[model samples]
Target: MSFNLSTLLMTIITSIIVIVIAIAGTRRLTTGVPKGMQNVLEWLVDFVYGIIGSTIGLKKGANFIFLALTLIMFIFVGNMLGLPMNFITVHDEPFSIFGIDIVTQQMINESEIIENGHKVVDVAWWKSPTADANVTLAMSVSIIILSQIFSIKYLGFKGYVKHYFEPHFLFFPLHIIEDFSKTLTLGFRLYGNIFAGEVLIGVILLMGMAGIVPLAIWQGFSIFVGFIQAYVFTILSMVYISQKISH
Candidate 1:
């Protein structure tokens, strides 16, 4: 399979953005008073704390605040990446970066139309990481696995295994399916929303000068949707983790 440079690029950019925000928010630690970025950081941290506390209880939730904070920030920023702008590379030949083949000659030949002697094909070079199902599903599966690990840590090996048979052992198969379902729903829910938003933006842009107003309106709405998706993903993850441990 050909590597998706856009997805990998967006993922790296998202990670760097999140890291920069973290450092900028906490660069100057002070006890006297909070000002500037410190205040913003405190508010964001408190928001995540509220989420964790409500879902898992404050005492137990303290440990997961870092994880939750990272998820919300990374996801929110990632969802917004493809909104205001996108870069498309018009490829007429094979392309690669850093020794990894991104677009191969065979791909270009198969995809490009041989019109006269010119080959033409377009590939998106930038987009939100969350816009790709591969990235979102990976995140979902990882979270589910981590939640199971948490269940084991809190409930011990026997309790963790027993969680599936809760209420009755006959439900074991149902519980297993439930885990897989959670992964699909959680991943696709975010993916569908973000990807649809991008597709709409692309359509609007096709209108050229006529799309300015609608594009602006939709971009505003898309930003709001991005934040909501990030929040929902974070909250659902915490819910999954807490519910497993509670059981």
Candidate 2:
């Protein structure tokens, strides 16, 4: 299946909706005695804050908890949302939205066509939004940017520079390299895990429709792995922020 800009946009919109709903659902519950979904969410919040507070300080850790929660919830939900087998592939079609013209898909003589304002072509819907390299890299870049921003804001220019040359000046290049590696690892880790999970689902589909048996197994594992990856990403972000803010 082929994915288009519209589908990507829809996926992002839905992801935002999921995050907002999650936040609102758990926001007002009493903190002392969490229950139901609030219990699970509070546990996640406390766990993340605990890591940050232990590594950095209580105040900064509490401040960064919202950012951590946002990233974790968004990515986790986005990855799991891919498992639902509910979507369609059709030709790109031109349509109007809010009086503004846009192109998507349309039916053409029992076949799907993608309208390019002037013409349409058959397109297939194949994978989840997170499976796209662009989306993964964009997320990575965003996290990296946040790291820099936090560093600059908390550490100042001199302190930020000092971060790259820790221990001694002789080891500056190695330290710089090591610091940059986190960004690369963070991006690729999420991309690799999500993409591999997606590919496994595709393999199951190819085996046969009766492949429903294995689909459940793959999807279940996908959810678990997705949560792990999200946690890793959030924790790393907190770690980076703490490292920056510490010095």
Candidate 3:
């Protein structure tokens, strides 16, 4: 998939927002009672921990809680970025900066529209990073690689290789294919859901341009979908990791 500059900018902005929230949330962390951001942070931590404990077993899951939290938070924030933003399209007429002409161009979800016999460029901002296959596949590949590393750490090189031949030598290819399938499915599942959600929201906004009701409803639902996808991705990652490391 192509990497759009707009997507990169949104990703960076999402990361910064998450970092700021984390820092602010923990700055006044108190042992006695949590309040404000700390309370929200604690709730999220507990929720993630519970998911880990249920899926991968509490003892083994503890080792990967930080990774799980990071994945969920990043994905969730990225998924939510597009919900409240509006897309803007600038006319192809060149704007000058320091006497240099810069033509306006569309980035992600670009569409062409003719106005008064002239074609104008449309640009979408703050598109979800998870909506991009490249970002999702990268995350999936990272998780798969980490799973293999954990498998080797616990199972040794010989044992790791031997996992492919379990049950019979004929099953080796199937086991190898399973690894590739896991990566593909994990990546596409997340990308498809988030991308579809964004497209739907865009359609709703366009259709209901004169009214705020449709946009308001879809935004709320999209936020819920974003959180659910984050949890699903994280839990599935934990499951894959547990499977690899299990004897």
Candidate 4:
């Protein structure tokens, strides 16, 4: 009944569908030239590969196809997950996962609820996974860890530490801090933009059917946002790896 609970339910169902599609497509790709869904999936994979290879160099990009594909598919599905709801419901209720405490939706007024006891929370129908800070932070941390792994493999311990200091002694701390800040910003920036877009969509829907006028507009804008976010995520990951491996 709570907003979080509803969001979780929708997200879970959406994720299952995405996973199933991915698995089916993956299995199909191993046998022969891709066809149907497999064809589409392969095209997506190739597109991601092209972008990554061009930006990071073929050797580095080929190694990163796994991360690139995961990000692109996850984000694409997350963005499209909430597209199919005729009526959206919102309510103030408690949420528990496997009997563990999580969060509850707090309602300020009774006027928000309909006769069915469902409160029409603004934009109650769709939620974006990338809109969550935890998801983005988790992804950013993964990229940082992978970069460090590459650094350790390519550069010996001495090189790793020395590279951070760069051309001067005075700027060492600043360089280290900048590296740390990049990880932080990568997470927060993606979360903020995607979440803002999600919220904006909700607001537009609340403005009435005329709001539907802008639905097409926002959908077009969202496609751009989705592609940009995916590219940014991949670019930052590649940049980190390149920085680590560079002399």
Which is the leading candidate under TM-score?
Answer: 1
Q: Clashing residue pairs in candidate 4, if any?
A: 90-119
User: Over all chains combined, what TM-score does candidate 3 have?
Assistant: 0.87
Off by over 4 Å in 2: 1-7, 23-36, 86-127
Candidate 3 has its poorest 10 consecutive residues by lDDT at 100-109
Q: For candidate 3, give the lDDT of residue 31.
A: 97
RMSD of 3: 3.3
Candidate 1 ranges with C-alpha deviation above 4 Å: 97-99, 104-119
- Report lDDT per candidate: 0.90, 0.71, 0.83, 0.70
Q: What is the TM-score of each candidate against the true structure?
A: 0.92, 0.76, 0.87, 0.77
lDDT of 1 by residue, 1-247 (tens): 6666778889999999999988987899898788888888899999999999889988888889999999999999999999989898776655667878877554465456666687676677788999988899999999999999999999999999999998899999999999999999999999999999999999999999999999999999999999999999999999999988885
Best by lDDT: 1
TM-score of model 2 vs. true structure: 0.76
- lDDT for residue 246 in candidate 4, whole number 0-100: 71
Q: Select the stronger candidate by TM-score from 1 and 3.
A: 1
lDDT by residue (144-178, candidate 3, tens digit) is 99999999998899989888899899999999999
Expressed as tens digits, the lDDT of each residue in 40-91 for candidate 4 is 7888888877867766777756777877777777766765654333245443
